[model samples]
Target: MKESVNSYVFHHCVTIPTIRKGGPRNNTKTYSTVDDAENHLSPQHFCLPHTLFNRSFLVAVILLELGFGSIPMATSLDTSSTYSGILSSSSPCFVRPSGSGTVYYYQAIQVTVFAWGMHTFSSSSLMDTFSCLYNETFFPDRSSQNLIESDDDSNGAHQFRIRLNLQPGRAYILVVTTFSEIVTGSFQITATGPMQPVLSSAQPITTTASYVLSSSSPEFARPYAYDYNNVPYQAILVTVSMTGMYTFKSSSSIDTSGYLYNEPFNSSDSYRNLIISDDDSGGNLQFQINASLQSSHSYVLVVTPYRKAVTGRFLIEAAGPERLELTTYRHSAGPYSCGNKLTCKAGGLLKIIKSMVISVGCVGLLIGVFCCRPCTNKRKRTLRQQLSLLRQNPISQANSIPLRNVSINTGRTNEIDRPYTISISTVAATYAEQPPPTYEAAVLSSQR
Candidate 1:
């Protein structure tokens, strides 16, 4: 009976009775104890164990199987450590310095317990999606050789596993981020190695990104130091995922200045939205600004020269607790304007010229309609009246003066008293507004 109890506890084998054709019979049947022990122990078995000793042994086995001393089953050493955390909007984000890709929550896991062996890093998502990245350097954008390995998913599961040989007593950064942007949830990470590896929560890494300011960039007025002049500037639209203080510094051969605006940057009204400005604080005529920023909020960072009309190429370095999404921002063009300062000013001059031309044309049109057009009409009417008068009475040029026939004496007078006579027709010319002369009058005038 004691042997039977031991078999059930250790080997999980149970004894059962069987029915035969002859009569009431007892044939021991073995059952696996891996399953529920209560299911295998039937009420009929109580009757089979007729003695009190076997009943006590059976009770002891049942108690052990029911989880009273289950830890005695050869439990191996726990050579792994687990950490749990949640990724939310409050978590620091990881962003690409190139400003392209999904933003990830910069979750860092610092190896606490030091071990001298190859470490296997694995992570599993509890609620939402996540991934794993192993790196030696705290900040990846500064050093490219820090990335040891990365894994998105393992065998189509929301878990990642990476095997890397890590140095003992040295800090190893494990970045647990999500697969998509703004995806937040809970996760679990386990680090297993030859020795126990303890993982603890660590602070977010400092994110640094570089950009340039050139001639073709935007321009704004320096609102600081009572100076309001247009200076060429580069506007960077910064979107931070974590709330903390950020530093911006400029590096260039020319004198550079920095300005931070809380909301949208307006060139015309830059002073109204100014949050902070720095000039020559970074040393060597460069600008350095340190301001507190918030998450889910946007800001404009303007890098310009300290003086007006100064333009050149310059580099901007932004450092923050979490990664910043930096994009080159250009102001939208107006209806009759362009983006660049030169083109926009040219457009304004063109608009002024256009307005002046329109005004001159309107004045000339008024003069022609009211003054010059009436004078032209009066002169045309006078010329028409004179033409009608000429058409009414025609002037006869041949009968302007009266003439009559006459006889003249010549050397041919000795020819039987014959004389040469000349004759002319009688006609009279008339003027406008005067009657024609009678034929008798015309004949009398000619004779006289």
Candidate 2:
């Protein structure tokens, strides 16, 4: 009987049974233990012993499988680390840096674990063999705690959740290990919040002008103008005031020979040339005159020891309005005399009158040249020829005339016999002249 029990345990413990056909039976029966069949198999052999032994073997195998094949239970514990893990053993774990800053705050932390084990007894008996353990450690304090609990319930698994109220700018560590069997697991934790930064202030400087000139020896000192406040200044509103001496000369030919000498001057040569420099501060901004000038002969010397800003367009309000007005200044040199110095005063007067007539005739000629209509084919042909000549030699024929003052004959006829002295003065004139009212006005006036 002992041999039979040992045989049954060994066969069922390692291998499952395979069905086979029965062939022979023993007529004689023997009893070795009390747990054997009651009949002792005296009359015939009984199969009850084989059936009872198989049933007991199956129950033991089932119990052993249940205990060994199941996973262990686990629980979470609180810690300062941003992350956590669970396993069969406990050891120090490191948390990665969360943000870029001197200080860091922890919002919350979490952990999880999984465990497994095995047994050699019945299901209920195997439950008593397995267990769960949770270990936690706090930083700075170094204080630690452990919890042990049975994990023998259904499926053999357990889970625990931990919440952490951690201090900022600190670190902590955690370790976990198993007690009875080879069960294992891991845990995780997280942290979150905001960070701060540093900054600095702005500085200021004075503005000055930078100049560029078209000519190598520019006549005037380039003026520097600017506004301070740092706010943008409007280029159009700003104006520059300049003061300097200007010299003018008229065309000698017109003074000595034109018929319109006494007539009111209507030509561009009547005015003085005023050139203004256009240079702003270092920003290189340029100012340009929006209007054109017609006068060139007359000159003015303005001395603006004082200046003022005015609101009107093109009108500069002077600090001393009266002093701002220009006065005539005479040069040491006398009126220019060209060609023969006549001995007869009558001849001088006649020459003056002839110059006046010639001036008028020139003006009339210009009007006729521009206004005459081509009434006939011959006139048109003549006009075309004149236009061609004018185009071919415009500067030589017209633009070369210089500016000069008109001279009136004031001496007596016999006075020309002696040395005649004439004085000349420079005067200021309008910067521009308006054109004749119409082409007809310009042409008809020529008849006189």
Candidate 3:
């Protein structure tokens, strides 16, 4: 009996017919097109677009079969795999040999394997010289810790190969670049391991969804680095179906910042549950957070502003293994408001009632005391008219006879200072020896 071996070939060959020119001192010959490069270096089978499209179409079909909304692990593995890609001027580049050095163009491909073991990566390029780096990060020159292993075609064979121990489900970056600066061309990578690897471009499939922050949204004391006090923001519950590195970015006119909190986000203690946060890293005063998230766990995405009380519409793009499950997250505890049932404690309620009573009582007393001048003046006018009528009666005024008492002063400061209740006869007798008292003088004497 013969054993059947699984083989999968993934290609990323895009042919740009634009002719490239090399520097004056450069000895490397430049190819005008992808076909010319393939004809010169690689086998005919390696550059076939039909095979590449067919594999992509197969993956798409598999995705649709699984609802096309989730990220699924590769079902099949190959003992050997082949991948092809091109490096143009538009490809991502970094300065070789660190600061103030020559710039080189490179392409980074993420390779993931289901079965862990030793994997070998070898590359063939149409250009005469190229190098490879098995790195943890994209720009290996930036940090030595990121560069796991590196190799160049020291044999002058126009090829490079590297061998490294890989863990299952961990994504390793295979960086391919030229030995010289500013060199661009097409290349192919063939990987062999315990299982056929899933070769995906370093870029993930990102899905952008629109959300909003407005007056009605819940608020929180954003992390101190962002703002001091509470700010209007929207919280999204992020749940991933697969575990992988994910990036969350915010785009809006409101200089936005983002905070990612682990399960059970406690707004009261934001820093404790916080997994990561960012501000203006996405450019244009937006936030970008890249984190490794676990499956079936809860994560809270907080969209706030760089300053307090900022509210507007914003778009959130989540890029990872799969489209994340995002929904508006209103904390089970809700917001802190005196009106909320959970937030209104007994002491708070008492304080609220006390405040209301004090405010209402003071306002009512002020209105009653200072707002009735016209009514008081009308009463005084009636009293004056009564006095004038008494003065008009000559016989009654001359007799100085006792009559019903007349109240004068209306204040209640003291018993004697209150409205006077003296008889008209007494008033006439008291003022008889002096000039007839004016009404104003009589009223002033009553007040005294």
TM-score per candidate, in order? 0.36, 0.13, 0.38
Q: Which pairs in model 3 have colliding backbones?
A: 78-196, 409-419
Which portions of model 3 show Cα errors greater than 4 Å? Answer: 1-202, 333-448
Cα lDDT tens digits for candidate 1, 343-388: 4466579899999999999999998789966875676567557545
Which lDDT tens digits does candidate 2 get at residues 1-448?
Answer: 2333554643211232222234123333343543443223223222224434554443432333333232211123322224343432111111112212211111111122211111111011221222222233222111122332223333333322222332333322322222223333443323221211011111111112211112221121112322211211111111112221111111111101001111111122222123332221111121211111112222222111001221111112111101222222222233221122332345569889999999999999998876654444455456557545654785755663222332333344652322122334332242245665888887888986
| lDDT per residue (tens digit) for residues 1-448 in model 3 | 1122235644444322222233133233444653454344322222333344444543433333333343332334449888888876445455543324445666768888778788888887777445455545553335234667767764348677787788885657777777777677898888888888777677555778789877887666777574557787777888778776567888788898889976556666667567788888677888877676777777889888777766789999887656798887765645421222332355468889999999999999999978786777776677668766776898977785444445466664643333346666767765677569899999999999
Ranking 2 against 3 by TM-score, winner: 3
Which of the two candidates, 1 or 3, achieves a greater lDDT against the reference?
3
Where model 2 places Cα greater than 4 Å from the true spot, the runs are 1-54, 58-93, 96-392, 395-448
Candidate 1: Cα lDDT at 38: 41
What is the Å distance of residue 179 in model 1 from its true position? 0.4
- Per-prediction count of colliding residue pairs? 1, 39, 2
Instruction: Tally clashing residue pairs in candidate 3.
Output: 2
